[model samples]
Target: MKKISIIFILFLCISISFEAKSQSFVGLRGGINIPSVNYTNFVRGPIVTGFRNEFFIAPSFGVSYRNMQSEKIGVQIDLNYSTKGWGQLTLLETNTFITRINYLELPFYLHWQLIGKKKLKFFVDAGVYVAWALSAEQEIANDVDLVENQIIYSVEKDNRGDFGIYAGAGVSYDFSIFILQLDGNFKSGFANILPVNPFIKENPPISTNQVPSVQLSVLFPISKD
Candidate 1:
């Protein structure tokens, strides 16, 4: 009986030590999104209609939670308010037009720690995300010098949802009580997002959406098992 009791206590101690080494984490994340469009052209559109795009900086903010199942592998989940769009602007002219679409997205990432030390870890993350469109909007400025009569257009019907794949690489620094991650991520959309200018159901003005960004996220431990 004494030998059996000792063995059980030793096992419990080993389990507790293992649990203490890996703690689950929660954090806040934010990034800048640069959106671009790829045309699925069946009929060639006008040259002027083709957007001369410049990176329109958009904001993405979210909450991230991580579950560490082992020393080198884990899962990350995030819920975010993300924006996508492009702008048509001529450098020589003041007239400008911009389109923006917003989404509420949930992304699930499979995280692999490739290399690590006590203070830092390098990781690769891959995942898929599903998003619902919150709204689509357009802003137009015919002439910048004149007393501005700006037009804001509300898109009534757009592709309502999107599903996509994401992949990224990052490094995380441990502060003991908190962690900071810096990652560069690319996301590719798998479906059409459009009302396609003339509301053409058969063909869209633009074929699909593209979103790519670099993110900085900070995390805290909610509880340790």
Candidate 2:
């Protein structure tokens, strides 16, 4: 099954590239990643209470290839490394709990250029992504001193293969050579990161990871005609 999928993807890419002519680009994207969860109830320690989920921004970077099928339509594909996790900060700000998970992700987006002028262009994209977990770690700190007053543990059992949806909108600037694009996007996981019945006792009952990001990308024309 995996071999067939790989072959199909390669064939699709070759077919698209064969027709792109001078209407293709290679790009790099770098940005902030805010990982979140969908569930409201999660417990930890001796205190069985809801997790106070907080913003835990991380770095995201990717390389992309895109071929414009028309003035207003294109397909963008990316291979990237991204960070996803959630953190908790209490009212006192003394104690903290954080989970850090990293993944190598591949995403495909259907790109639409809405207002393509000379200097600036507007666009929107929607797509899906597949991600494989690289690492998962959990940390708990009792004091903000950062003097290693914490408990660190690895996730015992995890749903490593993640499937998700992504959507975003932004504008790009044309430098007459390479285009620089800035955008805000969201990636939401449909599957839980934890097993339906986690093996570990401390693990969250249910968690759906969601990432919101602000991205900056630069695209270099493949073969300008």
* Candidates in order: C-alpha RMSD to true structure: 11.4, 5.2
lDDT of 1 by residue, 124-216 (tens): 987777788788777665764542222222446557677777789999999988999999887777766754556433444555668888899
Q: Tell me the lDDT of candidate 2.
A: 0.76
Model 1, TM vs. native: 0.75
Model 2 stretches with alpha carbons more than 4 Å out:
1-22, 42-48, 90-94, 139-141, 144-156, 198-205
lDDT of each: 0.71, 0.76
Error of 2 at 145 (Å): 13
Lowest-lDDT window of 10 residues in candidate 1?
A: 146-155
Query: How many steric overlaps does candidate 1 have?
Result: 0
Q: TM-scores of all models?
A: 0.75, 0.78
Q: Per-residue lDDT of 46-106 in model 2, one digit per residue for the tens?
A: 6654556667778889999988876777888889899887787664566787878888998
Model 1: per-residue Cα lDDT at residue 224: 64
TM-score of 2: 0.78
